[model samples]
Target: MRAVYILPALFVAGVVALSSVYIVDERKQALVLQFGQVKQVVEEPGLGFKLPFIQEVVSYEDRILGLPTQPIEVTPADDRRLVVDAFARWRITDLVKFRQAVGAGGEEVARQRLDRIINAAIREIMGGVPSTAVLSEDRTALMNRIRDIARRESGSLGVEVIDVRLTRTDLPEQNLEATFARMRAERQREAADEIARGNEAAQRVRAAADREQVEVTSEARKNAEIVRGEADAQRNAIYAEAFGRDPEFFAFTRSLTSYERAMQSGNSSIVLSPNSEFFDYMNGVTAPVAPEVPAAGQ
Candidate 1:
């Protein structure tokens, strides 16, 4: 009977010992509750002791958790609709507040609150900027606003919001295709204009070369005519001096030349006056000498 009574007490002590001690790691927060009521919160890493069987320990993540906010279709101030992908990194900053307002380690409830806060922030800040600016030059400012608003709104929820960032912003495919077509057409027009200017320059060069060729050929022909005229004048001056020295021989020579030309090619008709230059060598024919025969076998 004594052994049985001691045995039950020892078992109870063991259970109490097991339930009293709780450990909080460096990356976690611990919450202590007594009979469903908040007792003490452990925000630092250590061993925490609580009442056995009546007290409960709840653990929370001390490090940042990535929470992807719901993608919402929002129209910017310029009335362009886009889907916004936003997420935040946060951690539990207050263990007491986490257990008091919302249940400790209540990820679902926390996510619901974040969703509300993030949506409200997007509507106020990102939705106010034009779609062009939100997706481009003003994206940094918009992200800053979202982070600020989320931090402020979540401060009371025992969560510390580190930052918010946008993942993607895009124009619809149809819009992108139309933009490409316009860009291509503009480039083609510029290329065509350049080609036209090039062709015009080439034509000008060719025309100038053609005109230069014509001028050079004409100058060469004129120089050739001048040389031929000088040669002809010199021949006439020599002929007149020769004819003055021996008029009769010159006439006879000239007539003989004309007769030789006339008899070489024709037995055709001819017309002449009696006193014409063609008669200058008529009736003054000379006999030709025959070759002498060789004596036989001398």
Candidate 2:
């Protein structure tokens, strides 16, 4: 009877032990609520106790999570409309603030709050900066300002804003055609300027080449004249040398050579007698061919 009573007490204790529960995880915060009221909040990463069936434990994430991006269009200071697409990263900070402003597991609601905060910052910054800066040059600085403002405004969500980013900014599709036309016109103007420059350079090169060709031809003609004059001088010197050796024969040979060159043309039609100065060589050089001789010893 004593052993049976010991087993019954052990069973009751086991039932009580089964009623109590605890859990530990690295990337989550646990909130214990008793009868629909906050009992305690545990943020540390270790096992924690909760009264099972009486105190309910709700777990919330602690990891960095992506906040949904929302498309927003706002006009800059210059009155240019910009379609801003943006998103952010966040995590729960204080579970109490999170529960109050955003209900349990209300990530979408939190994301809505984030969009409001991010949009306010964007509007404020966009209102102050120039359109050119927003569209191009100073976008980085503008992004930093937006991030700072979003983080500051995100505190109510019980989360830290890890980063804020702009996914895209585009003009309306209706305005896109005009922008494309303007870009095309600008490119055409640039191309025309480049072609004009190329034409001007080509003309300059052609003119320079023409001038060089003229100078080269002039120099060649001058060189040819100099060679001809030198050849005439050499001929005169050779004539003087040969004439000094035999004056009579040199004069005779020169006269005969002149006659031969003057009469060498195909159409040599002269009306001078054979004994004239031009044909004196024919009479002086040799007798005419003898008439065909009679048969020998006829």
Candidate 3:
């Protein structure tokens, strides 16, 4: 009987000892709760105490945690819609407040609320800026703005947002084809305008060249006519000098030259008198002859 009582007592002591002591690790903090109410927070790493069988200890991570939200659609001031993928780095700052707000639901509840806060911040900040700015270097500023808003909003959950980042931003798939088509059309229109301007310039150049050619041709013809007239005048002067030097020889040579020219034509019919001066050189007659018609039968 003594041995049975001693064994039961020892078992009760062991149960009590196991229930009263809790361990906290360096990577985590603990909350002591009594009857579903928080009694003390164990922030340091080591052994801790609690009432046996009546108190409970909850552990929470002390390091930063990532809360990634689902991709959300947002429209900017430029009226362009985009899909935004983002995430937040955060950790518990106030253990007491954290316990009151999210200690019960633990990391799961904290993530849910933090996701909502981040999404709201992203929507509000992105909606105020143009899509071009969002895609530019200004995106850094926009992300910082989101982080500030998220930190403020998540403060109620005793969570401090270390940073907020936008991982990927893209135009909606449904709008890509339409946007590309519009850009192509704009480029084509600009190319056509350039071609038209170039063509007009080329036409002007061709017209100028044609005008220049006509002027050059007309000037050349005028110059050729002047040279021909000068030659004719010089020939007449030479002829007069020859006539003055020898009247009889000049007249004889002129008559012979005319006869030779008339006879060179194969089909020419001459009805001149047989004694005419035109044939005088051929007849070797020096006397002037009267003009006469040929006999009717001859």
Q: Best candidate per TM-score, number?
A: 2
Give the worst 10-residue stretch by lDDT in candidate 2: 287-296
Per-model tally of clashing residue pairs: 0, 1, 0
Q: Report the lDDT tens digits of candidate 3 across residue range 238-285.
A: 988987998777777676555556556455576778776666667877
What's the TM-score of each model vs. the native? 0.68, 0.71, 0.64
Compute the lDDT of residue 10 as modeled in candidate 1. 97
Each prediction's whole-model lDDT (CA): 0.77, 0.78, 0.86
Superposition-based RMSD of candidate 2 using all C-alpha atoms, in angstroms: 8.2
Q: TM-score of the candidate numbered 2?
A: 0.71
Worst 10 residues of 3 by lDDT: 289-298
Better of 2 and 3 by lDDT: 3
True lDDT of residue 113, candidate 3: 89
Q: What is the lDDT of residue 136 in candidate 3?
A: 80
Better candidate by TM-score, 1 or 3: 1
- Please provide, for model 2 over 1-298, each residue's C-alpha lDDT reduced to its tens digit, 9 standing for 90 to 100: 8999999999988876766767748888877888867889888888676776798777788888886567888888888788887778788888878877787656678888888888888889988876788778447778888989988988877778888777788897877899999999999999999999999999999999999999999999999999999999999999889879877667677665655555565544445566655455466653222112122222
* Runs in model 3 lying further than 4 Å from the true structure: 1-68, 95-112, 129-136, 246-298
Misplaced by over 4 Å in model 1 are 1-9, 205-298
